[model samples]
Target chain A: MSQKKSSEPTPLYFVGIDGGGTKCRAELYDTTGNLLGAGVAGAANIARNGDVARQSILDSVKAAIEHANLPPETLASTLACGGFAGANLPSASNALKQWQHPFHSFYFTSDLHTALYGAHDGANGAVLVIGTGSCAAALKDGELTQFGGHGFLLGDKGSGAWLGKQAVVHTLEAIDAIQPKGQLAEAVCDHYQAHSATALVDKLNQANPGVFGELCPIILELAHHAEPTAQALVKEGCEYLSAIARKAIQQSNGALVLAGGVAHALQPLLDSDVQAKLTSSTHGPEWGAIMLYQHGAFNQGANA
Target chain B: MSQKKSSEPTPLYFVGIDGGGTKCRAELYDTTGNLLGAGVAGAANIARNGDVARQSILDSVKAAIEHANLPPETLASTLACGGFAGANLPSASNALKQWQHPFHSFYFTSDLHTALYGAHDGANGAVLVIGTGSCAAALKDGELTQFGGHGFLLGDKGSGAWLGKQAVVHTLEAIDAIQPKGQLAEAVCDHYQAHSATALVDKLNQANPGVFGELCPIILELAHHAEPTAQALVKEGCEYLSAIARKAIQQSNGALVLAGGVAHALQPLLDSDVQAKLTSSTHGPEWGAIMLYQHGAFNQGANA
Candidate 1:
C-alpha cells in the first residue's frame, strides 16, 4: 500500500455556509474537522431574492476558499452545506436543491436549524436569534420547532429592525408634534440631521430593514441611558423576547442560547428566569451546518 | 357684431384634479363653474413615484375629457389645477412643475390645501383624510398647517394601512404562539387559509400597504362585533384619529371633515368630544382644487 501512492484515499474538504437576510457566511474545514478559513458576503435570503442569494453563496464560497489558501478549483472537490433564511418554506428548499451548484455535494436547511445546532454543539437545546430579525427555535429528541421569526413586516418584534422602525416612527411623531420631543426622538432627529419632516421622509421613504437595522445600536445606547421612549420600546421588545425564550426552554427543557448582533445587549434585560437558562453557544452556524450535513437530516424534508 | 364673434374672449374651461396614494380624480367644469364630467384613475402620490403619478394625472384628465364628450384637444386649452398628496414636498413640487404638461396652464398644491378648501367651500376650515393614508390639516387666518400624515411606514397611525398592518402583526404573533389565537387571528387565518406559519408568510411576504389597507373593512367589522384584538386595535387607532381631530379643530376653530375610504367606518368609533367637531366635507378634493385655482392660491408654494 505504501508503494502505490495512487491507491491512497483523497482528502476531503467541507464548506459550511450560513446565509440570512442580511449576510452570507462560509467556513472551510479540513478532514480532521479543523477550521481552515472563513468568509462573509452580502445578503443571501433565498426566498426573498434567490438570484442575489445564489450569487452571494457563490461569492462566499469562493472567498472562503481563497481565505483557506486553497486552489479556486477546490470547490469542485468540496462538499458544501448551507442553512439559509427563508429556506424553511418547502418551495424555497426545493428551489435551492434545484440549483446547478458547483460543489461535489450540496445540502440545504433553515438558518434557524444551523443556529440552534451551533448553540448546543449538536445537542438538544434552544436558541433565540435577536439580530436584524428575530426568531426562536428548540430541538427536542431530534425534532425541531420554531416560532416568532416572521421578518420585519409581520413580526420580528424584538429585532434590531423593529427597534429601528420604532425609533423612526417616534421621531416622525415628534416632528409632527403628535408626540412630545423626547430624548429618543431628539437623538433620532440629530442622528439623521433631518431638520424638517419632509426632508426626513425623503431620506427614509424607501429605506429597507438593513438601513433601519443600523439604528439599533443607537436605540440600545439610548435605552441604556434610560431615555423614556427608548426605555419603553426596549422594555416592550424584551418582553416579547423573554416570552420566546421561556417558550423555547419549556418546549425543550434544555439550556438556551441568545445569539445574534443585538442578543448580548438584550440578554441582561430578559426575564430573570429566562436569563438563568441562557448558555454560551458552543460553535457558530457554519459548524452547525457541517454537523447537520453529516447527520443525514439535511437530505430529508424542510424541517430536517 | 355677430360676424366678429370670434374676436370676443373665449370662455375658459377648467380641470381640477385630486391625487393621493390610492387614486387620481379629475373634474371638468365650464367657465360658469358648472360640472361637466368626472373621471378616476390610479395612484398619484407625486413624491412616492413621480413618473407613475404623472401618468395617472394625464390619464385622469383624458378620462374626464372623454366623460365630458369633449375632444382630446380640449386638454390643451384647459386650465389645470392638481392637489396631490406628495406635492407638499418642495422636490415633488418642482418635479411636477417641470412636466411638459398639455394644459394651457397647470398649477399644483398640497392635497391637504385642496381638501381644507373643499371642506369649507373655499373658506377656512380643517380636514382629516382618513382613507388609505391619514393626515389632518387645518387652515386658520388664511394659513394652512398639516400634521399626522406621514404615509404608511412612518406615521399614518389611524389609517387603513396601519390597521391592516396591525391585524397582520397580531395574526403572526398568534401563529407563533406568542399570543392567543383570538377571533381576529382566526379570521385572518381563514381569510388567507394559511394552515402553516410559513404558508401565511408566503401569502403576505411581499404585500404593499394597499393590500393591507383592504383589510380595514374586515378589521372594522370584527371590532364592531367586539372581537378583543380588533376592538383593541380599532380603539387605539380611533384614539389617535381623535387626537388628530382635536388638534385640527383647536388650531383652526372650525369644523373638521373626515374624508377617506375608511373615514365613515372610523367616524363613530372616534372620541365623542372630537366627533362633535366633525362635519361632512362641503365638497370633494377635485372641487377644492378648482376653488384653490379660482382663488389664485395654486400658483404659490407647496402649501398653496
Candidate 2:
C-alpha cells in the first residue's frame, strides 16, 4: 500500500530487468499486470564495467518504454527492480546504486537471486545457472544459501567460459607438442586461425570471459559428435554441475531450476539425480524482479 | 662496426634491460664491458600494460645512469637492448616500438630470448624460465625455437601465477563444500582475510595476475612443508616444466639453464634428466641483452 496523492492518484508502471554478462533483458508492465513491452540490450555485468552496465540498464529500459508506446516522462513514475550478474560484488553493487537513474525508484540484487525467485514463483527453491559463467543458489525458508558461483578467475567449472578457455589451454599444449590434440583443439584453432601458441596468445592476451565463451558451441557440438577432448570437457562440466545440483537439492529440499544461456544445451547432459530434481520456472527473472519491487515497495511503506 | 661521424665516433654507453612480469631490471656497461651500474623498476609485461613497460624501460635506464654517476642526459647517448614479457604479442610489440624513446636506440625482443642469450652467453642452448610466468626456448644455428609460455590465462603451468591461482581455486572449492580445504587453502584464506566465498570473490573480482601471484610464497612454503595440496600444485607445475625441458634438450642438444625469480627454489625439484642438462647462466638477461644489442648494431651497420 504505497502512500498516494489524494488529489490525483495516477496508475503506476513497473520494469524488471535481468542484466547478465551477455545481454540485458527488460520487461515493462502496467499496474494491472499486463506485459506491455520487452527489450534486450548489451552486456551488463556490473563487476566488469560499471559504465557499461549503467548504460545498458538505461538503454534497455528506454527501449522497453519505446516498444510499449509510453511517453518518455513515464520513466519518472515507474518502479524498477533488477537482478544483475556480478552485482554480488559489494563494490559493483554500490557503484550501480550510485547511478543517477531515471526511474521513480530502483531495487537491485544478484542475477542469481531474481532467477531463483522466478524459478520458484517467489517461494523457496534452488537454481543452477550455466551460461558464460556458472553458479548455484538455494533458498531455504527466507535465507539464501549459495555454493560454487565463484567468478571466472576462480573456476566456474561448468561455465561456457570455462569450457572455451580449456579449449585454448589444450591447444597450447598441443602446439607445444606436450599432448596429441583432439578434434576439439583443431576446431578451436581453426576458429581463431591460431596455428601456433604465440599466435593464439597474441589474440587472447586481454580477452574477457565472453570471448572464450564464444567457443562453447564448438565444444558442445564436438562433444555431441563424440570428440574425446570435447566430450571430456563437457563431462568435467557435468561433474561440477551435478555436485552443486545435489547439494542445492539436499540443502533446500526443493526442486532445482536450471537456467541461463547454456542451460538447455547442458540440460540433458546433467546427471540423473540432478535431472530428477530439476523443474521448469513459472516466470522469467524480469517478472520475478517486478514481484521483488512490489514486495520491497510495500515493506518500505509499511516501515515508514 | 656501427657507422660514425667523421668529426667524432662517440664511445656509446649501453644499458641492457630484462623487463619481466614482476620487475624491470637494467644493467649499464661501458664499451669495454665493465659493469657501470644496475637499476630495477616495476612490472613491465608489455602485453599487459604497454605504457607501464615503456615507462619502466626509461625509468630503469635513468636509474642506472644515476647509479653510474652519469648525467641525466646520458640516456640520450645510451644504446639500449631489452627483453620484455608479453612482447611476443604483436600488438604489444608494435606499441613498444611506437614509443618515443629517449635512447640512442632501443631494441626489443621477448624476455625469454634475452634469458636464453644470457644463459649460454649468447651461444646455442636452451633455457627454461620459471618466475611469475613460465616458458622455454631453444636456440641453435641462428634460429630460436620457443615452447610453452602461452601466459597466465592460458595456463603457464608451474609459474608463480599458476600456483597461486590454483590455491584460490582450491580454496573456493573448499569454501563451496566441494572439497576439503587444505593447508594451502587455509593459508590463502588468512592472506586475503576472506573467510567466506563471497568475500574472496569481492576482494579478487578485479585482481590482476600479480595479486594472485602474491600468494606464491605461501604456496611454496606450504609445499616445502609437505602440504599435500601445495605439493600437488608444485608437482603439476614440475610435470609441465619437465615436458618442455625435455623438448628443449632434444631440439637444441645444448645445456639447459634454469632461470627466473623462482628458478633456484624449484631447481632441485626438477627431474634428474632435466637437472642433468642444467648449466649455470653465464650472465643475466640484462647482460645477454647487451650482447644482442652489440650484435644487432653490428649487423645493422654492416647492412647499411
The prediction achieving the highest lDDT against the true structure is 2
Runs with alpha carbons beyond 4 Å of true place in candidate 2: A1-11, A297-304, B1-11, B297-304
Instruction: Supply DockQ values for each candidate.
Output: 0.44, 0.75
lDDT of 2 by residue, B1-304 (tens): 3322335435379888999888899999998999999999988999988888888888899899999999998886777788899877777777776677777666778898888887888788999999889989998864678888888888679988888888898998888888887788889999999898888989876676778889988988999999999999999999999899889888888999988878888888889999998888899999888887766621222100
Model 1 CAPRI quality: acceptable
Q: List the residue pairs that clash in candidate 1.
A: none
Task: Report the C-alpha lDDT of model 1 over A24-126, residue by residue, as the tens digit.
Answer: 9999999779989888998887877888899999999999999999999998777788888888776677787768777766777888999888779878899
Per-prediction TM-score: 0.90, 0.94
Cα lDDT, model 1, residue B64: 94
